[model samples]
Structures are given as C-alpha cells and as structure tokens.
Target: MLTIGEFAQLTHLSVRTLRRYHDAGLLEPARVDQASGYRYYSAEQIPAAQVIHRLRELDVPLPDVQRILQTPDPGTRAGLVADHLQRLEDQLERTRAAVTSLQRLLRPEPATLDVELRAVPATTVAAVEATVELDDVLAWYSGAMAELDALVGTPGPPGGLYDNELFTTGRGRVLVHRPVTAPPRTGRVHPVTLPAVELAVTTHVGDHDTIDVTYGELGSWVVEHTLAVAGPVRETYLVGPRDDPDPTAWRTEIGWPVFRLAPG
Candidate 1:
C-alpha cells in the first residue's frame, strides 16, 4: 500500500491531482483512513495511473478520457484512440498551413510592380463553370476540374476567368479551364473560345490561399500604367497544386485584359 504522497512520487503525479482524480471517481484509493481522512493506493494502481497520464498527454478531452477508461472491448478502445489521433493530425495540418501563410505575409520582399504589355493569342479549350459562393469555391473548382480533365484526356495549364461583377454582388463565377489543341467534342465539356486580346500580367509566387495581396498590387500596377481595363481577370495556374511538395511553392499568373494607352 502507498500513501497519497508516496503514490504521487511513484506515479510522478502531484498529490493534488491524485485527490482530484479520486474526487472525479476516476482513480479511487485502495483504502481510506476514516478517522484521519487519509487515502492510500495498492501497488497495482500504478499501471492505471500511467495509462491516464499518457492519454492526458495526447490532450484527449476529459469526457473522452472517461469513456475510454470505461470501455471494455479492445477493438473499440483502439478505434477511439485512432479517431483521436486522426483529429490531432488534421489539426496539426491546419496549424502548419496557417503558419506558412503568416510567414509569406510577413516576408519582406521587393514588390514586383512592373507592368508588362503582351498580346495574348486566341485559343480554344474544354471547360466547366460554376456560379458559387466564395466559401465553397475551392471544392467546386476541384470537382469541375476533374470532370473537365476527364473529358479532354489531355493535361494542360489550368486557368480561371473571374467576372468582377459577381464579387461585388456577393456571388462569383468560376471556370475550371484548360487549353486544348482543338475544338471541344465531349460530354458536358463545352468548347471555350478565347479571343485575341491585349493583357497586363504579373506573376505571383506562393500558395493561392492568400494571394489576394498580390492581385491587389497587380491591379494597382495596371491602373497606374494607364491601361484601360477591358474584361474579366484571368488566373493562370502555372504550377498545379499536386506538382509541388509544399503548397507554398505553387505559382499563379494574374492576367487582366486591357487596351493599350495612346502615346502621351
């Protein structure tokens, strides 16, 4: 038998925690001195204390810990632990993404506010489009891109055309677009013919998660360059998501159609 203080030393759990566990009906002592109100534990309780300490290390919720402690079937107990581990992994991934996003936003890099004038050629491709709320855009785009790729049977550069009117109106129009060598002739994948036009473009080097700042900088550059905005802004995904081991390595090109300025 071990006194509360001795048990605390042996388990490395503080005396206060042992009392709390007893009060919570989690770990009861082997015997209690009724007159002195002293608690004692048998030598066998150490293993249970060790298990509790490990579960707590995982940051498992107390209610979950209680349920796990009471669960009898070995398979069921293992499943519960696996589920908690999966949740932790998912949370870790989100935290990593947030950290990377913050790092990019805080990095002091020279702003590439250069304005380049280029004549874009007319092209045709198979495309699928959706009018979606901003929050659901990524998932919707992924599904549409998958369908478009299946129909085209050829992988090519990914791009999207955004109509500004939708954003100001709380809705956005997006297309899962890819350039094709010929006219479209497949199911639900319609041929998209882009007319030749002048464009002002800037390349953004980072994850699309927070590329809005780059877009804002580029748009300002176009206005300052005296280019007259003509049509929807196009985002050409130069590096697809799966191509990079780290999402932060992806690159995107922001192109906005414009009319050339007359000589000053």
Candidate 2:
C-alpha cells in the first residue's frame, strides 16, 4: 500500500485530483485511515489511475470515464473511446473547411471568375433522386451517390441536378446521376431525361466546401451580363473524389440555364 502523496508521485497525478476522483467514485483509494482520514492506494490501482488520467486528457466526460472504468470488457471500453474520437475528427474537418473558405473570401484580389455559354444536348442517364431539405442535402447526396456507384459503377463522370426551390425555399428535388449506355432502374435509381438548355457554365476547382462561393460569383456574372435564369442549376463532376484523392485536382462544372435579357 502507498500513501496518497506517494501514489500521486507514482502516477504523476496531484493529491487534490485523487481526492476529487475519490469523491466522484472514479478512482477510490484502496484503503482509508479510520482515525486521521488519510487515503491509501495499492500498486494494483496504478494502471486504472493511469487509464483515467489518459481519458481525461482526451476531454472524455466524467460519466463516460466512470463507465469505462466500471466496464470489464476491453472491447466495450475501446468502442466508447473510438466513438468520441470520431466525433472530434468530424468537428476538426468542419473547422478546417471553414478556415479554408474564409481564407479564400478574405483574399485582397481574388482570381477572376471566367464563364462560358454552351448549348448542351439532352441526354438520359441512370440517377438516384430525392426530395431533400436544404440543410440535409449533403447527407442525402452522400447516400444517393453511394447507391448510384453500387448500381452503375463508373460509366462516366457523375453529375447532379439541384432544384432552385431547394436553395430558395429550403426543400426540393435533387438528382445524382451517372451517364450510362443502359440506365438501370433499381431502388430509387432510374433513367432520367435531361432536357437541353443554354447554360452559362463555370468550373469550380477543389473541395465542395467552397463551391457556394463559386455559385455566388457565377450568379453575379449572370446578372452583370443581363441574363435571366430559366431552370434548375446543373453540376457536372468531371474530376471528382472517385477519380483523384487530391481535392485540388477535382473539377466541377456549374451550369445555370439562362436566356439573354438584352440581345447583343
């Protein structure tokens, strides 16, 4: 047995922390003096103390730490820790995305936005579609894309058609598709006929995190050029995550159906 101070020295934890842990029922000492009220811990408790300390360092909640200590199964304890770690990773990625977007927005002289007018012919493709809320679009698209990939393989670079109402009014139809010789109809997947239209097209390079900024730039260009938007926005993923792991190499074409308001 070792005194509280001695155990703290061994574990590199403070005496006050040990007392608090005892009060919280997280790490009770092995024994306590009846008269003078001194806490004592055994060498066997050292490993448990070290584990609690490590968990605390990861910002694990006190209740979770207590649960981990109480649980005897190593796998269960590992799973609890893994779940928290994954949440932290997701939050970190969001933070990184926000920082990247802000950095671009804050640049003194941003790159010029270049656009083109093209007449794209109507075509049919295999697609998975949904009536999704604006806030839920990303999550919905992820699941939809996975389904399309499983059904169609990589027949061609994928594309998505997003309804204007989805952005303007918060809920609308969304379609994720791939061009295939023989479009399959399975589950939510089906063949879609995309009508040809005059598109004011611009390519956005890199992650979709900053794609909205590109959208704003394109909208500004359309207004400046005196054109009226006619239909849902179209996105053609020419070089995407499926083709290259490097986000910088990903190229997406943003197309807006528009007609000239003032003849040139």
Q: Candidate 1 residues 216-255, lDDT tens each? A: 7777777777888898788888885757777667888888
| Ten-residue stretch with the least lDDT total in model 2 | 255-264
The global C-alpha lDDT for each of the candidates, from Candidate 1 onward, is 0.81, 0.92
How well does candidate 2 score on lDDT at residue 9? 100
Instruction: Tell how far residue 243 is off in model 1, in angstroms.
Output: 3.3
State candidate 1's TM-score.
0.67
Q: lDDT value for candidate 1?
A: 0.81
TM-score of each: 0.67, 0.78
**Strongest candidate by TM-score:** 2
Q: Give the Å shift of residue 35 in candidate 2.
A: 10
Q: Model 1, residue 233: displacement in angstroms? A: 3.1
Q: What is the per-residue lDDT of model 2 for residues 16-117, given as tens digits with 9 covering 90 to 100?
A: 999999999999989999998999999999999999999999888889999988889999989999998998888787798889888878999878899999
